[model samples]
Target: MSFRVGNAFSDPRVTMRQPQPVVLIRGTLNPAHVSAFYATAFPELASWLNLNRIPVSGPPVTLSHIASSTMMEVAAAYPVTVKVPTTQRITMGTLPGGPVASLIVQGSHEYLADGYDHLRAWLGENGYGPGPVSWASYIRLPDEHGDQRACVTELSWPIA
Candidate 1:
């Protein structure tokens, strides 16, 4: 079934963020197959991090190139406590940190795009435009062994 977003909520404050080290997995995937894509991608990232002895300092993040809807080059990233080396699909990079607008979403994964729509609308309303990229940080994910009724995500766009 096609997903539809309902209502969206945003934090009142938009802040400047500092650049931080992250390990990312980049690939192109269809929007409709994101769940399956992540299922295979995230674990490989997790294993790579574990094998490299890197500690996860923050939530999992997925960044997208905002230009296309059919197929997108997306990056799945995990913030690390310390800088690490680039290897294979996982690479060392910085998550874009600067002027950003964010929306906190709490719901099923299928509806997460609704949060992005809200954020985009809010950015345009406030005279902010997409700065080449946008990201969704999974504040809370479905359990490894089970699913949850709600998931918490922060949808953010770097803005001018």
Candidate 2:
């Protein structure tokens, strides 16, 4: 399917989201491995949930800690209906959602820095201050072994 490139909500707005629970795997990855990482991580998470009879609650979310041009420390997660026990490589936690500034970045994951910058700028322009954290929830991942240009990434920043 073709993905369009533009703002997530067209007109940016501050919205409140309820807390969500997720099953996540934290790891370090370079830009080159982003696609591969998600490709491998999601299915593995899904299989684990399926094996344990857990139900999915929301879309996949990638919580980035430090994303530089060289490396990124990220938590790949899928929201779950109930609390799930932690595994050797995976853990469960709640994403405390409150007021947020959000947008959509349609393209490769490598350009996400620009997207984040854009959100920060918007927050500043509108007199909204950023909170301690931010995250990217993937709406559409790139095709397996396909071009990254068609990817659709959603970015959200906690704001006050």
Candidate 3:
């Protein structure tokens, strides 16, 4: 319910009016309690949205999934590399661009929500009240280190 008196575009750090695409990655966290961690995130994120003005909702633990969005790249889309050419003639790269909000969190999944809290707070205080943009998860493709405990992911939401 809090709307800022002016536009948030005054800052270069905040990008407004752009297009983006969706991406997903399998995630594994330390202590293996990502479920419980995300569960605690929603309620706080909800309040942060209102306190700002973006009017975002859900991301409820019910979905059982989450992602971060980055600028769309059709050629780079779909991490599942297709070595064989498709005979079925289909659109290959139709990526889009737009405004987006993003956040980075380090450590365990339990702390993901905290970083989100910080993001929402910064948005509310800055300007960019909740806007329309699919929440695209673009976490780094797992590293070869074979250490699931050190996995890291970036959470992004596209906007315009």
Candidate 4:
């Protein structure tokens, strides 16, 4: 399918879009803390975790849910063709119409963090403020495959 790059929301959040099924969990998480998060949060649930890393930009999530403090909301995502949950049989890549901002970059996660910092500062300047932390995920960009520099991910911040 041809994913068109949108300049703006042409018709609000109702535009025809491809949304994927995902799972989500909340609470403080990072690469070091993810193992504990998984163990404590959803032990009995099925899993489809891709390349593992602590998130410095987007919100910590899985294939189906966005676990926030008070609400558990579903999101939009593209398909992940990896075998994860046999029953679910799908993964997520990105969530279009992210409601705030998105930045796609090809670099290390640290570089991505730099970009995120810049975006955060820019948002402050533009009065966007802080929104829900969301992410457009991808398969292993940087992982045990020795391609630590090619991790490409889209960082999205749904601002308030």
Q: Any runs in candidate 1 off by more than 4 Å, and if so which?
A: 1-8, 67-69
Residue-wise C-alpha lDDT for candidate 4, range 1-160, written one tens digit per residue: 1222431111112123343343333344334454455455443332334433212233333322235554344333333333233324233344434346655545555554455565566577777764544554543455677575666555556566
**Better by lDDT, candidate 4 or 3:** 4
How much does candidate 4 score in TM-score?
0.45
Return whichever of 1 and 4 wins on TM-score.
1
Q: State which candidate has the highest TM-score.
A: 1
Tell me which of candidates 2 and 4 scores higher on TM-score.
2
For model 4, the superposed segments whose C-alpha errors exceed 4 Å read: 1-21, 25-98
Compared with the true structure, all predictions reach lDDT values of: 0.77, 0.77, 0.36, 0.43
Most lDDT-accurate candidate: 2
Which residue pairs show collisions in model 2? none
Q: State the lDDT of candidate 1 residue by residue for 1-160, as single tens digits.
A: 1233445444424789987678898888787776677788889999988987889999999888744768877788998868788877679778777887877776666666766777787788888887777888899887775574467788878886
Model 2 C-alpha lDDT per residue in residues 26-125, reported as the tens digit of each score: 7788867866887788788888888989888777897765556698877779888887888899898667678888877777877778778878888999
Question: How do all the candidates rank in terms of lDDT, highest first?
Answer: 2, 1, 4, 3
| Model 1 vs truth, CA RMSD | 4.3
Of 3 and 4, which scores higher on TM-score? Answer: 4
lDDT of 2 at 74: 72
Q: Sum up the clashes in candidate 2.
A: 0
Query: Model 4 misses residue 10 by how many Å?
Result: 22
**Candidate 3 per-residue lDDT over residues 1-160, each given as its tens digit:** 1212332111213445333221222223433454454444434444443454442221221112223242221111232122322223211221235565655444345545554555556667777654432232324323586443443434444433
